[model samples]
Target: MEIGAYQDAQFGQERTQERSEGSAGSMADLFPKLVAMQRLCGSTAFAVLSVHAHTLLKPGKIECTTQSPGSQEFVSPFLKLNTEFLLSHLCSSPCPVIFMPENAQAMDSSPACIVRNQAVTETSLAFPVQLGTLGNGFVMFFDARAMLSNDLLIDLHRKSLTVMREKLRLAFGMTTGSENLNDREIECLQLVGNGMKSEAIGEQLNLSVHTVNAYLGSATTKLNAVNRIQAIAKAIRLGIIA
Candidate 1:
């Protein structure tokens, strides 16, 4: 469902699309800035990923797969060191600017651990950027020596990300507005992400099971998600669902 001022509809669409059109070609222009941010944050490395809707809907899977990651360029030695863990962590969760094992460090938290044993850096921070209609993506920073504190990480997201958000969104080539969600759909998703089943959600929302599923399905399609679960995850990442 699209919403707009009746008179400004064309103008609004044109404006957002115009913004999207120029972003794709300028993605590479942000590399130098990212490198500078990494240095300022005292991190050893940094990287970015673009979440792709087409890749998310691959057959037989409700979630995006690492076999075909939706990440944008800005690779580094971390990819070669802890490939799958990094992708899974970055792509799956909302992970809004989290410091790895805050106030400390760890090892062997299974395959998805960022540090990945003693081989990589001691600390890592992830900033999950919300690009409005551009879909979701993240910027990660890793530290080799000192523990990257939470304050620093939050500063990066609050101050640094603000400057970088529009630039990164353009890089993703998001010209048009992203999928829209009515109050009903977003309400259903918030409950779903809270571990509610369809029946429970229906009762809570005072609607029939069929109606609840309809809203959910509509949201799923709009988000280009493979299923309700995927929809919920993406919704959380996009700040659509808390």
Candidate 2:
């Protein structure tokens, strides 16, 4: 069947209603719901999992996982490479959420061949969800065979973002609008992870020493670190720097 045509029939309103009823509570709750949603949308298999400290994308560790049918053969090397590439690409996005379709080109064309040459027998999609304002990591994955409608895909993406946001809020004990950090603070923290000293960073960015210090200090406070070094370390642990 034509891809577009298939998407229309399978992703009609009834499917959306089925998906809407799926409640997402814990990782365990969400995973089954994802798998069920994929099935309802005509996919053979599906999985949804998240990573904590995703350093492969930045500096520290990240929590990520993918779920598929038990019958599917496990390919460790390809999975690792794919995960690495996904995280690296996600680092460039301002919004913490990323929806990556398997056969689609990356936004940044620099590493154009990351997945082009790989042999993918089954169709699949992956989502890279950055956990919190601190850059914790993501949860994602869907079935490509499902040929989910663009509207359905979009709905899932939006819902997934909401779930991740709520999870992070609870995990970090943050309230609405209380933990938002600006881009400058994030950039400064990333530079600190690269071992750039305050004065050097100031020169690199054409900012005054006092301004650089202020950025670092603000970042440190936001990250709940007592000092710059501690801030850097926390940033790394939180997957904010790389």
Candidate 3:
């Protein structure tokens, strides 16, 4: 069925209520309908990516995905595209950005050109989701068939945002607390959460080991954490880091 059919159906009302109430909906509650919607939109696979505060272009984690084994091979290649540009565009606009394979081909000099020859889909769509202090993320739909109309794109964007907001609420509630971490402290905590040691994080950030430790220590104090590991865990729970 087309998107209009979905809008006319009872499921559409459910979506409306979900957005209106800001319910703490689970993936299990939304995934089935999302899969059906993707099928209607001619999307073969979809993924929700959580982006780090420091590394906006790099995904901190694949929160969830509907990619099959066959389509999994395309994921790495797809990510090689100009993500910095894509993310900047997302942050600038709330609409869906359509990416054609030819667009990838035009970037032959860049690593993004790799998708030109191997992409399985003729088109893809990306939607940006901003969760204020909680964080920011993206919802990507891959391998679409036809060009989507503006109304459908808008409806889909709203639905996608609804889904993401619910997921974020379930994943990270509004308990970020009064602890305000600076960019450097958050970066250090994020690195520690990813299992990076002080020396390694120092080298990566071009800071001295002492500086890294100082940042971690400051973050630990702000978080009221007794140690680095606890601080990392608290940061993750507080949505201070991915």
Could you tell me which 10 consecutive residues in candidate 1 have the lowest summed lDDT?
59-68
Error of 3 at 95 (Å): 2.2
Measured against the true structure, the TM-scores of the candidates, in listed sequence, are 0.40, 0.45, 0.51
lDDT of 3 by residue, 128-173 (tens): 6665444466677778764465555656666766666566546654
lDDT of 3: 0.61
Q: How many backbone clashes does every candidate have?
A: 3, 11, 0
Candidate order by decreasing lDDT: 3, 1, 2
In angstroms, give how far residue 99 of model 1 lies from its true place: 8.6
Local lDDT at 41 for model 1:
69
Question: Using TM-score as the measure, which candidate wins?
Answer: 3
Note the Cα lDDT for every prediction shown. Answer: 0.52, 0.52, 0.61
**What local lDDT does model 1 show for residue 62?**
19
Off by over 4 Å in 3: 1-25, 55-71, 103-121, 173-242
lDDT (Cα, tens digit) per residue for candidate 1, span 40-140: 66766666654433355542111221111223222444455545554465455433333343435443221122333454324555555544344445666
Candidate 2 per-residue lDDT over residues 1-242, each given as its tens digit: 34344334433542354345533345455556566555645555544445444446765434335465552343343355466665565565422222333565444422111244345544444445554455434434433454444455545544554445445444555422224456678778778778788799889889988998898888888877788888766555443443
